[model samples]
Target chain A: MNGRCVITVGDLGEFGIVARIAGRLPQGRTVLLGPGDDAALVDAPDGRVVVTTDLLLENRHFRLDWSSAYDIGRKAAAQNLADVVAMGAVPTGVVVGLGLPATTAAGWLDDLADGFRDECDLVGASVVGGDTTRCDLVVIGVTALGDLGGRAPVTRSGARPGDVVAVAGRLGHAAAGLALLQAGRAGGAGPGDPAPAELETLVDAHRRPRPPYPCGVQAAELGATAMLDVSDGLLQDLGHIAEAGGVGVALDLSAFTVPEELETAARLLGADPLDWVLTGGEDHALAATFPGGVRLPPAWTEIGRVTEGEGVEAGDRTSEHRGWDHFRT
Target chain B: MNGRCVITVGDLGEFGIVARIAGRLPQGRTVLLGPGDDAALVDAPDGRVVVTTDLLLENRHFRLDWSSAYDIGRKAAAQNLADVVAMGAVPTGVVVGLGLPATTAAGWLDDLADGFRDECDLVGASVVGGDTTRCDLVVIGVTALGDLGGRAPVTRSGARPGDVVAVAGRLGHAAAGLALLQAGRAGGAGPGDPAPAELETLVDAHRRPRPPYPCGVQAAELGATAMLDVSDGLLQDLGHIAEAGGVGVALDLSAFTVPEELETAARLLGADPLDWVLTGGEDHALAATFPGGVRLPPAWTEIGRVTEGEGVEAGDRTSEHRGWDHFRT
Candidate 1:
């Protein structure tokens, strides 16, 4: 017989588990109705709502051994919330659909809910409602909603020639962290040999991405043209802006200030740091374009210039990598 | 070599598949910005929006051999849409996150999209945006958004002791259909012997639930005190209202008009017809409580009454079954 008195989800039943999760979450001001209802009611003050959805499956999107349940929860919420902000809207609430194996521990789910609540709190949003079901593996589906605040949506097609391209959050940090973790898993390091503080920071970045939530609204208020979350690599995501707007984006690679940790990790791993910055995905940075002559705020860094052509180029070389494609890549 | 060339999602790629699906879906009036952007912008004419989510796994929630992809898509959208209407709101749009195996045929996805579109078209809603990813099994997450149209939401906690309970739409049909399918799978029936029309109707009900979409609004407009969609068994869902309102629900077994198909199926299988009507789930029938003096419309059938105590009772006996629990049952 097992000595530990661990409770599984099957033991608690659906309603019991839902009650535990709901009891812990604090409702936001915009939530008219929270959990324990047929549906949640969220305030859409501006008469329009921006919506986005994402799916993360176990092993494909994340591994349980590599990231904790809390980490997965944060990452899942972060990615969808980033999408809402990318539309130049203020996020109001999120509804999640979680499918987990019946054998999953009850504590693991509680930690997951805590991660969702904490991450939502960072942006003044809340977990308004969700549905949980039994499945063979852990699959998370998050849909985030936001209010546009009476402003015209900044879409990808609005970018044009003579615009300046910029970004508002970290790049390559998650990728470098991922590399470190992969190497560590390959017998490079164990619990006995702790990673350096800087390297550990990278690993943490991969585990839970902290997107610049307010920067999206700020960019729109500043009259930014096209915008999107840099979920794909820098060059490939820029290519979307170019393709949508019928223009070209030329990047100046020298403008990027590679963090010391990325450089050091790259040196040790025999990899190109520039590649991580240019082609890595999952950082969820805000990439946008503005009129060429506009004085940009400090939060955004100019990375490239829009040109009268097609596709994306970086420092006289055309990029071939198009970032992550779930099926093909 | 294979006899026929089949285009899988892996061969078509993510962008290609998205473009194909997007090309097929026509934008609704409420969609300010449709797919191909970071997020979709939906017009919420009222100040509040109703949202709900549900997850459907391949084997657990449905079996591919028993139901078509189109049937699964309709069922997924219907369940969430029903939740919205249960709150007295009209569904505006839906965002889906789908995880499919790399080997899934492109045509199957197209049919699924068609089903979603057709179902949305029924209620003047549309598929605004979605995310697709690769997984070992097919998992679908659907989040539906609705506009309350300035009406106060009808919650489950509003039932009073003197209130009368009523139901709208089909009940026990889906459950009866499921039992038939399970029997057929266990070698009871084959293609050589076609099922009667009534049995086929039950099977179809299980595959695609026909939730009375407009009845929810009708009930609210007619002054429903408490309401919920019966996705779980009638007794189980009524128990939720009873518990929430701090009152007991006493259902009359004689009040129900069991469909002939249910009776025929029950007779053939040696099962109780009353059990199907009382405990069957997934029909998405709307159950509501109203003032005892009020006359319910023709769409609603009075079935029970609110009492001073807690829990649900049918005729003289209290219910023992608690319907479908994702983790436990």
Candidate 2:
């Protein structure tokens, strides 16, 4: 760190920066032509590709002051990869669009690329190609492509009455972490900080969401119908399925046993843990509705049932709006 | 326009804005499942997908004050589509990631979508999916997918000595138009305004580049050794070919006959038209090197030839740097 040249992106120039970024990426078998080309060729073995895009603005989607470049990269990759998983597909490759300030340190980009590569490696995917440009703020746009592997894509419009609604990963943790950070109680915590285990877990989840990626494919194999990643809170994301499928979802709150850690953390903050469970988003959890009487996959925990009508209900509380509205804030 | 709602994007919210934007796009045969789902399914018939991505930041790439939202959308689509074409493939679909201020007019997004659709229509492609987020400045990220139609991708490394260099689109027009805009001479010119016809043509070209999309496939069919779109000026872009092919490119100055209008416009501005022709970029013209004996396509004009050694030369004047460097500014 002391002897090496730490040049800025401006000093390296666009082509130079691109060359370095491309050099560090490990191209897998899927990449026929990698960077330094007009376009990249990736084998889509399934004959059809599942494509999804996500835009992450600097302060809106992430805050550099709170999260390191590595965390930001992981978060960006996780969210986009989860989108492909939600479609019941195997992740293939991702093309990224990165906008950085000219004065940004080149090492920051290196760490970001490592983050992308590491996250992609978790799903057996690869970073194929990307475009880099200059912007005042860091803007990351990821377009993830996936292969269905002969399975039908599970869309949000297939849930029906009598279907069991289930979730495959933790919820509300990210929101709780965000709350802790917003309150300035978590970001500065160090290795020996006296933060509770629950608070620490929530904060880490907020920084890097570990979505249950495999469960998406497993759910599809087990005949799950309507599906989506829990991005805009559980109830809010569930509402999308309800509205798309023209059905209602009535969640059994008792099925969700609030973790003792979360309860303690909630009590510490004087906030309702139930609200976080119902409305906290960005967990990247897979929520699906399966036909009743089918053997449930081990990864899934039944939490609700599809009902006749519209909107979502938790216990006796039914509402049409229970999610995050990006523009409202 | 009077009593009806003129809601901003903030008023409509993310889902509402997405619904409105998705409602207006014409999904073609390629899109199996379009925008309302977590991801879109587009057919990749050739079992391979040619992919590329680009980021366009406001002010850095396009200025909202100078171009309409519609024009901005068209420009973004054109650049990405040109990348696919440059790879010797036909475009299939595009997924856009748009970052906008919440206060942006909902109608602006509608026009942007229309512009995207209009440009896609020109290339027989569709808008498959997108993600939108709130940001201080408008940033557009487009990932374009293309089908190779069973042909090997034309890469930059295929150019060799004894190849005839040719181009299939206009040169220097966009740069000339940018100059006019920068001089504050074109935007305010009305129908009866005193702006020269040539200046108007340049400004229009700058606003919307019409790449010779088909010529890419045509060049591939003709067994051209190498091909790329002229994105960073003839000299600057050709340098990519030279570096990649391990060869030199020599341009014939006499081969270029400056358009009378461009010359007149250049004189009016006291600028040398030759400099614009030599250093201008973003015309998105197909630049290729065909075998010397191959019958030159009618769409292409012979401009130069591949030479031994390295770097590019034009009438004994040669420089490694002659194009836009994003970090330089």
Candidate 3:
């Protein structure tokens, strides 16, 4: 191990690191001009562009020991891309701003770039440009751009009182995984210990969330009234739609089917799976409202209905879940 | 002072902080939907969008002690917007991602947001959307988007032999200001001490770079062969133009008129004024190559000529000024 020298970011410098990252990414159809220019030129054929940004800080957002650089990269991209789809737009490209310590191994950055590229590839998008700076810790800021493709954006304020609330993709898996990880770190069977395959899948879900990309467009085509990605939990995000549209959400408790992986992890960790399903975040699921009679595809599951009152109600109980607040939590 | 209660970011929480910031910003004409949505919708009238990203880290990019929250916000927005204009586009909007310590004062963030708005207003843009998260320090990521206006982007790779190299906007002022601040911190006349008005101007330049925004599109309309913003010093950035176009640049030393403020600061600090002009970064001046004999606008000044060889040669001297490398420097 001593014989193999690790090349750090300082060794290659900013330009060299940028070249390496840009070299690994393949351009998508929307990128008229890619990295190396002062700014990238992206085709916005619809005459309107959808933009969103998110920040991920080391330790605050992810632990280096818990997740690999690749995992962090994927999570960062997925979160931002999910936002674009939630706007009913097809993602065109992403421009990243990275802050890393000089002592970081250069290979870690290469793997991170690969992770960004792979995640983008899934949606037929690419990383167009980025800026890198030396900082005391690792910080990643991803800004994703998308085209509306002539469709009116499905905003949070569009849901009507009689509309049906639905979701696409998994819920509670990431929260359950997070619970397990926290438990493991607190003297339970640690990450290094042997675990059941079901538990491992939950851990993987927390590490890298796979958001349903195409479902966003499908919901839009199917005439979604209001939509957003479930980032700050289902109830909390639904509250946004409720507040915006001046309508209330009533979620059916029996409508949810807790995955076996989440159930297994919750049982092992002695946690409430329902609480995670209702209040846990980072699943990147698509939640939208449609007209009461509109047909939703198999990917979408009707979980609730819009009501005249304010706030969110799950079954017969008023939801007290405020979800994740960065500063307060 | 003892009786006054300070509201920290933690007190406001993420939603409160976001609401406070968004409530203060006025949406620009380009914004179809602003801060309340999952993503912002910005008009791209020309069917193409120019996008760029930049990261500014606390202590690494700005010192809270030296610059106010307002100044940091201005600089952040200015730098990213400069990149957009450099692409021969009219800036439309910006999306910011902020990471801040929970203990930070809520007022500081308000001022920062105000700074973003004021700076963007200069070019008819607005802060469309942003994400705020808790972290150990303040980290800012700004992504600026612009409309191409059907103009071909003047990339750095289009320069050719015999093209005239010209520049618009002040150069080396920010560098001089930085030198003055560094000197002040090193026990030379401190910022607290009263200084000459000229020196104060230099310091102000470093804190808030005012790039000549309109000149970018002007250059493009006037048939600029190649162009880029001079953020990495004149010689080093010109070297990029040289390397990209497979040509050489020969800058005329006599053509540069050292500003009085820079000269005064240099004399006080016992540094070479020319060195600052050639090697200082962050002024955000526009440098472009134009066809020979084209009637140049009054805003543009002929500085040099693109030559048949490689690298940059200034006044018979091969410059050794390697500009700032975030990691190495």
Higher-lDDT candidate of 1 and 2 = 1
What TM-score quantifies how close candidate 1 is to the native fold?
A: 0.97
lDDT of each: 0.88, 0.87, 0.90
Candidate 3, overall lDDT?
0.90
lDDT of 2 by residue, B1-329 (tens): 22346778887888998899999898998888899898999989989999999999988889998889999888899989999999899999999998888878888999999999999999999999898878888889999999998999999999999999999988888888888788776855643335576578888888889999999999999998888888778888899999999999999988987887678668766787877777888778889999998887688999889999788999755884488877675
Off by over 4 Å in 2: A1-5, A187-194, B1-5, B187-194
Off by over 4 Å in 3: A1-4, A185-194, B1-4, B185-194
lDDT tens readout by residue for model 3, A80-155: 9999999999999999999998888988998899999999999999999999999888999999999989999999
Q: Which is the better candidate, 2 or 3, if ranked by DockQ?
A: 3
* DockQ winner: 3
lDDT of 1 by residue, A98-198 (tens): 99888888899999999999999988899999999988889999999999999999899888889999999999888888888887722336543545666
Estimate the TM-score of every prediction: 0.97, 0.96, 0.97
- DockQ for model 2 equals 0.85
Query: What are the DockQ scores of the candidates, in order?
Result: 0.90, 0.85, 0.91
